[model samples]
Target: MKTAAIRALPASATVFPILFMISTVHLLNDSMQSTVTALFPVLRESQHLSYGQIGLIAFMMNITASFLQPLVGWFADKKPRPYILPIGVCFTLLGVVMLALAPSFAMILLSVTAIGVGSAVFHPESSRVAYLAAGSNRGLAQSIFQVGGNIGSSLGPVMTALIFIPLGQKGVLLFVIAAVAGIVLQTVVARWYAAVGAAPKPKKAVAHDEKSALKLSAGKVRMSVGILILLVFSKHVYLSSFTSFYSLYLIDDFGVGKQQAQWYLFAFLVASAAGTFIGGPLADRFGRRNIIWLSILGTAPFSIALPYADPFWSAVLCICAGFVLSSAFSIIVVYAQELLPGKIGLVSGLFFGLAFGLGGLGSALLGEIADHTSISTVMHICAYLPLLGIFTLLLPKDAELRGR
Candidate 1:
């Protein structure tokens, strides 16, 4: 019925309104997710938790978020489910309530898992919706969609420091308001999606472009994807260091107050949001590979220099790193879509899932390292991860594609 409903409607010219609505939903949803990490300091002090325990919370949440995305995308690709968008937000709403009221660590873990499920459900379908609404400007549409999440992530720490820190765990319940907003927004978007016309058809086994230029065999295709995955790992693991622990790093290393540290985090994430908005347009103009190269590899010097800077200088370095590093992921997603041509959902899910999984694992492992060693040491270690972006050399040049 949903598929038929979509099929009956005509394709939209652009549907910027729907795209913006979906992006707003992404913002609300991710702000709630970012709250988990944002409250680390408060949670640690309140519960007498260790850094490892804090990381474990992130691990539990992100592992579930990451693991199920591919399956969700795979299912959505085969059978479109527009209504699931609001249903997914319901999971997040319930999780928010659970986190607010939970008494034990076990309950917190369960709460995070519920939230993770919502995120896993939300990403692929919403991404497909953005593609449907993209018209001819796929890059701009993707950037607009992604920038919402980055902005939400940027806002989370500030909100946490202001609300959650003073009001205690109960302050988290305030986010239920955002969850409700997400549900209402997503429901409307889902209805619009159901009326957006037929979904993009999936290519059979191989992209036609794969056959024409440079003649990539199955092995080469796999190799190329593997390289992209490695790049994702390098980018995400390094990002995890900041997203999961940067505040703690500031508090411990520089003797910065928790609220001040959050401000620094806000600065970095705002820069990330700006970078995300810029990447897609640049990629659309110059080619995706160029953006990928600059975003992932170009940030290395600042990343390496960040650990050694004073607090003010460190903040500046973080902004610079965030600006450059945050640009690649959206471009990566569009590039992968172009690579496979038809399996948008599957590709979005795979990359998003891997990012979450790596982030979770990296957070957990890095948390343990911080517990055993020092936060400063973790910073220095993560500083060099961006250097691995040199591997981008392995990717095929964008100009070589015979057909886009």
Candidate 2:
């Protein structure tokens, strides 16, 4: 019988090749997404747009992804479609082409929505792939997967400085190559996923995990999830301030040129990428709860000081804040997954969706604040957001999670 054959096949081991391939695709996917943010200054100048408009653009893209990712993940949990990987990249490809030629603000929104659709399909599915390929090293696997995204995100500032400033909105066309590469790489990954799917899942193990997950009362689980969501909201809203407005702040307050300002943002993002890479391994060695606690709370001092620092010190503070703050996200995702075992796709999708949604919402609100007040005020307000890390204390300890 097919079941007998599937059972006869050995259990899957850590699949590094698949993980790397998926990580590369994530880099490509996120780099393409980052192009939208990178285009902000060019668009603002060319269209004579306001801060609120800029925030709307970011919201359009990110909110679309936020709304759709959970659905994509839920569907995948029920019935995964391997070919969806390449299909998702096709959407991004179309978005890239449309973005390059978009003449009106409306067209830009439509184009970003397409890119958002692509991202929605890509993240949950690819995260599931990372989970499948992870075997026992889930933390390391997630870190590898997440570091690519942080690195890719860091490229936005670089692109703004190097490419978009010179090429204008048309520069977006260049990233079509990243989309094509993503498609090819995703195809390879899809095949491996398909092969993996042919193996029968360990239902008994899954049942055990499900039972273990339920050991906490429903109320306890709900409370835990609520706390995690709060943690995510706090982390992402703070990050949104940096991503959406930090460059403009530098330009307006510090007298830096727009292009020069991007370099500062780049430093912060690059530091974030480094932090993301280390956070997972550290969580694997230390407790996830400990790392999450340290990562989010530890950034408070630097973030609190950043608003008052001079240019040189501002950059240092931003870098420090970014490095420390970025470490918690991957660990948070991993912790959430452990909390609700067997719903990997759903949990990943929910957290990732919250991240994008909350960040987008924060950006939109903060942009309005910036338009009404000064960017400096925005920075000072966001500086205190990290203090919300105190809530992490409410989370159940790592040993409790493992024991359950």
Cα lDDT, all candidates: 0.86, 0.88
Q: Which pairs clash in model 2?
A: none
User: What are the C-alpha RMSDs, in order, of all predicted structures?
Assistant: 3.0, 2.9
The regions of model 2 sitting more than 4 angstroms off are 1-12, 197-200
Q: Pick the candidate with the highest TM-score.
A: 2
Candidate 2 TM-score, C-alpha based:
0.96
Candidate 1: tens digits of C-alpha lDDT, residues 86-127: 999999999999999988889999999999999999998888
Tens digit of per-residue lDDT, candidate 2, span 329-404? 9889889988988777888889889899998899899889989998898999999998888988988888777654
234 in model 2: Cα distance from truth in Å?
1.0
